[model samples]
Target: MANFIKPYNDDPFVGHLATPITSSAVTRAILQNLPAYRFGLTPLLRGLEIGLAHGYFFIGPFAKLGPLRDSDVGLLAGFMSTIGFIVILTIGLTIYGAATFGQEKSSGNPNDLQTKKAWDEFKGGFFVGACGSAGFAFICLSSIPTFTV
Candidate 1:
């Protein structure tokens, strides 16, 4: 029927073909709708993405090192690295957030709402980023054959 064909007929590629071989509409529809960030999901998701990427790149060379060559030692390194990363990021973000958002109306007053909010956001992002990186790094490192093997 004309109605059935109209949808395909409207498409440039499909119109020229006897049958619609591929459906661009389906792809277009999916591309249009994506998940929106609500609450603090953005930082968490970003951290995971960044951490995975970091892990992917980090595992290779580090795994080959002397102490890290052992799976147990490597895992410990990963944990240590994660902890260190988290601490560094926390301190740096806290300082940055405080300086940027914690402008005290009165010179001597130190506590404020904005600074707390900024720190919370940074905390969410970096915590995931560091943990994710370490987890992925360890997983990848474990798979490799060590010198003992």
Candidate 2:
């Protein structure tokens, strides 16, 4: 029998998480599976690329103004709204992921004390901080041109 975590087509009911199982763990797993030469290039990279592109396109120069700024007021408003949404969700998920996985591995797993301590420290490390940061950048960049005109 397949695990409940891995969704299946036959039953078609047990969906994935309301969001994705995204964390540094998923990114780390991909890193471990890849060749050293491909260190920074991965599916995660492509996804980030697409996300940045989408954000850019949404708030791009062309979209913000073309003559009838009145007609585009709604689109501009929505772009800012989603950027805010993604940013807020990113922060919430960061806190939740840190608490959930940090406790699971370090607090009670009977692993080596140093190992657990290191994990406890690293759970809120640089990459995790960067996730929140990227969201912030997106929110800022996505809202920048829209508000000025």
RMSD (Å) per prediction: 11.1, 11.5
Best by lDDT: 1
Best by TM-score: 1
Worst 10 residues of 1 by lDDT: 105-114
* Model 2 ranges off by over 4 Å: 1-47, 53-72, 103-149
Residue-pair clash count for candidate 2? 0
Off by over 4 Å in 1: 1-41, 55-75, 103-119, 147-149
**lDDT, model 2, position 48:** 46
Q: Give residue 136's error in model 1 in angstroms.
A: 2.1
Clashing pairs in 2: none
Compute the lDDT of residue 92 as modeled in candidate 2: 66
